[model samples]
Every structure is written in structure tokens, then in C-alpha cells.
Target: MKRLLLFPVVCLLLQFSYAQSRDEAAVTQAVENLRKAMVDGDKAALEKVSDDKLSYGHSNGNLEDKATFVGNIVSGKSDFVKIDLSGQTITIVGNTAIVRHVLDAETNDGGKPGTVHLRVLLVWAKEGGQWKLLARQAVKEPVK
Candidate 1:
């Protein structure tokens, strides 16, 4: 009798672990999609991956709404020539996923070239069965 109960509990635990791993993979893909969109300046892709009420925070303490974030990329005001992400971690809690990573990027905004290195935190929420970016905050990394 105890063995029978233990079997069900073990199965349920395995099932839940599998589901969480799947969600983590989905959130990882969403983050990759957003990175590509930012580099390509694809307005449609950007809009698709981000929530309607996105709160984007820059390392310099600037904040932008969804429209401004999309528009800046599309208009070349915030251009990402290349982006490399490392040390990424994703944690899922209910319908929300919190992601953190180090972002190193080359930028050419308004015809001036520059580089950016920052630690970024991203919040993604499952909406309509898709993971969409809900919020982001970045802080400059210490000089190395």
C-alpha cells in the first residue's frame, strides 16, 4: 500500500520537473528571439516578443515603454550591431520567468559606434500560451 502511494508521488514529481524544464526552454528561446530582433531592428519581431506594457530600463537609468523601446530600435536611435550573452540563468515561478545574464554588445546608434557591457535582468510572462517580455532592467558592469 505504501509503495503504491510512493509510486504516484514520484511520478507526479517527475512530471512537474519536466514541465518546468520545458517552460525554461521556452523562456530561453524567447530571450534569444528578443536578442535577434534587437540586433536586426525588426519592429514586428520586437513587438511580437514583448508585452504591451513592457517596462524597459537602461543601465543609465532611463526607462521606456513598449512603444518607445520598439520605436527606438526601429528608428536607429538604439542600434545593436552585435549582442553576446553569457552567464544566463532562468528561474520560473508560476506564469513568470525571471532571467539574468551578462550582455556584451556592439552598438552603432545614430552613426556613432560604441560598446556596452551590462548585467541584465529580464522578466517574462506567459501570455496567450507564449512567453513575452514583461520587463527589463540593466546595470553597468564593473570595469575589468
Candidate 2:
């Protein structure tokens, strides 16, 4: 009787492990999609991947909602010339994921060009069976 009960518990644990892996992979893909959409200025893709209540915080203490973020990027006001991410890690908890990465980018926002190196944290949630970016915060890294 004890062995039989243990078997079901083991099976459930294994199933949960598998589901977690799959969800992690999906969230990772969503992060990549967001980067591509930003560079390509694909508003449709941005809208698709971002939650309606997105809170995008910049390194310079600026904040934007989903509409403003997509609009600025798509309208050449917040243009990203290139973005390279390093030291990326993703952690999944139930229906939410937390992603951390070092971001290096060349940006041309409002006709002013600059390069930025920052540490970024992103929160993603599974909504309607899809991963969507829910919040983001970036902090400028000290010069090395």
C-alpha cells in the first residue's frame, strides 16, 4: 500500500517537472520575440507579446505603459540600433516567470544616439495560454 501511494506521488512530481521545463522554454522564446520585435519595430508582434498592463521602466527613471512603449519604438522615437543580451537567466514560478539579463544596446531615441549597458529584469506571465511581458525594469550598470 505504501509503495503504491509513493508511485503516484513520484509520477505527479515528474509530470510537474516536465511542465515546468516546457513553460520555461516558452518564456525564453517570448523574451527573444520581444527583442526581435523591438529591433524590427513590429508593433503587431509587440502588442501580441506584451500584457495590456505592462510597466516598462527605463534606466533613466522613466516609465511607460504598453501602448506608449510600442508606439515610441515603432515610431522611430525610441529606436534600438542593436541589442545584445548576456548572462541571461530565467526562473519560472507557477504561472509567472522572472528573467534577468545584462543588456548592451545602441539606441537612437529622438534623434540622439547613445550606447547603454544595463542590467535588466523582466517579468512574464502566462495569460490566455500565451506568455506575455508584464513588467520590466532596467538599471544602469557601473562602468568597468
Candidate 3:
């Protein structure tokens, strides 16, 4: 009798674990999609992956809303020539996920070449069954 009860409990725990993992994977994929969109300057992709009320903050303390963020990237005013991410972590709590990573990128903003090294924080929320970027902020990485 005890074994029968334990079996159901174990199954429920397993199901919950699977669901959590699935959400994590989805968040990871959403992050990747955003990276690709930024590099490619794909306006539609950028708009699709980000929430309408996105708040993007730069390492220099500049802040942009969704329209400004998307417009700058799409217009090549803030261009990302290449982007590399490392040490990424994703944690999901209910419908929100918090992500952190190191961002090393080559950029060509306003026709001037540059590179950036920063630690980034991203917040994503599940909306309409899709994970969308809700907010992002970056801080300069410490020199090694």
C-alpha cells in the first residue's frame, strides 16, 4: 500500500522535473534567437523575440525602450558584427526566467568599429506560450 502511494508521488515529481527542464530549454533557445537577431539585424526577429515593453540598458547607463532598441539595430545605428556568449545560466521561477552571461562582441555602431566585453543580465517572461525578452542590462566586465 505504501509502495503504491510512493509510486504516484514519484511520478508526479518526475513530471514536474520534466516540465521545468522543458521551460529552461525554451528560455535558452529564446536567448539564442535574440543573439542571432541582433547580429543579423533582423528587425522582425528582434520584434518577435522581445516584449513590447522591453527595457534595454547599456553598460554606459543608457536605456532604451523596445522601439528604440529595435530601430537602432535594424537601422545599423547600433550594429553587432559578431557576438559571443559564455558562462550562461538560466533560472526559471513560475512564468519568469532570469538569465546571466558574459557577452563579448564586435560592433560597428554608426560606422565606427568597436568591441565590447560585458556581463549581461536578461529577464524573460512566458507570454502567449512563447518566451519573450522582458528586460536586459549590461555592466562592463572587470579587466583580467
Segments of candidate 1 deviating more than 4 angstroms? none
Residue pairs in collision within model 1: none
Ranking by TM-score: 1, 3, 2
lDDT ranking, high to low: 1, 3, 2
Residue-wise C-alpha lDDT for candidate 1, range 68-128, written one tens digit per residue: 9999999999999999999999999999999999999999998799999999999999988
Give all TM-scores, in the order shown: 0.98, 0.94, 0.97
lDDT of 3: 0.97
Q: Report the number of clashing residue pairs per model.
A: 0, 0, 0
lDDT preference between candidates 2 and 3, better one: 3
Q: Report each candidate's C-alpha RMSD, comma-separated, in the order given.
A: 0.7, 1.2, 0.8
Residue pairs with clashing backbones, model 2: none
**Candidate 3 local lDDT, 8-124, one digit each (tens):** 999999999999999999999999999999999999999999999999999999999999999999999999999999999999999999999999999999999999999999999
TM-score (C-alpha) between model 1 and the true structure:
0.98
